[model samples]
Target: MKRESRQTTGGQAWVVNRKKEDKKMEPKWLTERRQKAAEDFKTLPLPKTDEFWRRTNLSRIPFDQFEPIQSVTNGAAKGSASRYLPVPMMVSGELLYGEKMSPATLDPNSQKAGVILDGLQNALEKYPELVLKYFGKGFQNRHEKFLAQNEAFWQTGVFCYIPKNTQVELPILLASHFSGGNQSAAPRLLIVLDKGAKTTIVHYASSETENDSIFLNNVVEIYIEEEAHLTYIDSQALSDQTFEIAQKRIELETNAKLKWVLDIQGSKLSKTNIETVLKGSGAAAEVLGLLCGNKKQHLELYAWTQHAAPHTTADILIKGTANDAAKTIFQGMIRIEKAAQGTESYMANNNLVLSEKAHADSIPRLEIEADDVRASHGATIGQVDAEQLFYLETRGLNREEAEHLIVEGFYEDIFGRIPVESVREVMRKNIEKKVGVIA
Candidate 1:
């Protein structure tokens, strides 16, 4: 494992930790970038007065309560030989690699397949041109305050580059965790697939400690070249005490294809943004998300797609359930530029309100500047079907059992679409526990 870092007189780096014997000095350009980002973070304050903050309350953040990690922290369970374990598998395609403890523990098979996978710092030292070219493409620091803060403080990230026309047989896993020692985290990921390359990645995230009141900020960017295909699945079950703010965006070239799935079943409060830009003709994208929130947990999700070239296509669907006093929000938008003739796009959000006090909000918007395009958006919010429950109870099941079957049937289609069985089982178990159906 190659390690690269910058040490201060305080005897540590503010971002990721490294051993004394394996330290690789930081490059001049990277050091300068880090310094500038830190300065930007200090100058840019959190957005408290913005119109975006109107729906959700941001006043509860404890800015001064937690501190950064001083040493290496790994939450791998005891007796496990590998530092990492498989968490989210179904939607994640071939090759499972995790950033459990150190960034160097890449899959040997993937390395042999000409897949370049390593920590962001290590990759920065080895591939400066590629890293710098796509670090922050469509989104700029000035576009969002939290994004700027993340750019400044981000110490740990992954860089994955797949050579042209190469296929790995196993699923690759990308994982991150917020341990007890590290209450606040900022991590980013950059993925680049050369022309004709095809790969699938399963993104899994969790908390090291069982439960801790912490904050997390994460960002990911993917660049797909012409004729390439990328399948990415974001599945995380973090502790309920954590506040998660994450964004993921993608850019696709001519003939490129992308499949994205998100399963958010944990966290006390979270706000997520996922966007895609079809920059080439014949490029296509698919997005799916499933989430469950209970008690006082709150979740807000955003998705946007832009058709910048003729013949581009995008499809999006999201389903969620809110129980107890929990709440959920989903907002989706589609944009067809004037030059993007023959573009096709559609979006929908469906939510299940299990409790009278729970609330679900859905907003779908579209901006069309193209004369030849097909686009539409829709949303629905309702309670469990009383007829279904009555039919189930009339048979052999009890009230709880009947409700459980109804809810299970509702998510059956989405769960069935996941490719892995073990992951599907785990997700089913979690949904049961969260919604009090399969206890």
Candidate 2:
């Protein structure tokens, strides 16, 4: 594949110049969808002017310099997959993606239950109808530039489907590890749980090294049918020189339940948006986020929970800590529609500024249209408490140790909410490394 030079006009010439042989092989509907997104990407402006993007600037990024990955290739080393797997032995299925996605490994029971877990390209070839039925159906942001770009140029993806009334006893793991610099990748993921299904999924994304400069724009869509349950853990620990923009959309039907955990600890600049919509009565969602930023890193997150039906409920809590000259931003919103009577929603964001040069921002909002709904929001931005530090120091701990203990305490609440012990441990270790508690 040939790399195209940056164009001053919209920086989208590369899309037109990309190879079309692979596109020609894809289904007509899929090809047409990509074509529409390509056109949309050419016209949609960078989201810097939007209110949600006002806190973070996208103008500084060299959008045209990075070469887009053209195809799926094994970007990671052989026999090195264990590093990316959260629990190698415990998972019922595993899919690893470098530039190319590996064949999924599933247990016999899961396969016999009609579960489908495979690379998106393979899934499209083998089960086009299933892929077409749910692909891009839950995404509500039609005009976002990055979302459109992913839709147009995504080279690798994971597709997982749990059949109706089937329950997977173990979690499934999807891991992506990019290995090069000066490259960009668009990876998409689709997960569908039919009615009365139950499962847990762990999605992890990272770069091979801590210093590789890359750009990653990814999208994930999830659908939970009536009475289905899903526990999703999404974690990102990319290179310090990577710029990542990610969006995850989830839709829940009647009596559906979701527990979502988001852990972000890496990337030079990361902007993530997570939206969950309760479209049926008795649907519920619980979201927990942990962000740790160090050095000159900038991490921003936007979480929105929408209650569109009566008896729906949502709870969101996000905690972050910034060290050195790092910056962190959290924006949360809870919306209750007019027909969502008996809706219960709450959102809270708390931040700890570890150094004077560090910065943190927290914004919480609530929009309630239903008379009987209970919605509230709160936020806090403060430095490490001097009294608490002193108290820990008095217990024979050094200054660094005391600060680490306090930071650990701050994140303990979020960790306790995570159902998977291994995932919690992995996140705890990452947090410790970020806080300089461990090498």
Q: Which residue runs does candidate 2 get wrong by more than 4 Å?
A: 1-13, 21-24, 73-81, 86-89, 209-212
Best by TM-score: 2
Give the 10-residue window scoring lowest on summed lDDT in candidate 2. Answer: 1-10
Clashes of each: 10, 0
What do the candidate models score in CA lDDT, each in turn?
A: 0.71, 0.84
lDDT, residue 93, model 2: 83
Q: Compared with the true structure, what per-residue lDDT tens digits does model 1 show for residues 384-423?
A: 7778778988887887777667767777777766765655
lDDT of 1 at 199: 80
Error of 2 at 415 (Å): 1.1
Q: What is the TM-score of each candidate against the true structure?
A: 0.85, 0.94
lDDT of 2 by residue, 181-254 (tens): 67888899999999999999988888854444678888999999999999999988887888888989999999
The TM-score of predicted model 1 comes to 0.85
Pairs of colliding residues, candidate 1: 94-170, 94-171, 94-172, 95-170, 95-171, 95-172, 96-171, 96-172, 96-173, 97-173
Cα RMSD for predicted model 1: 6.4
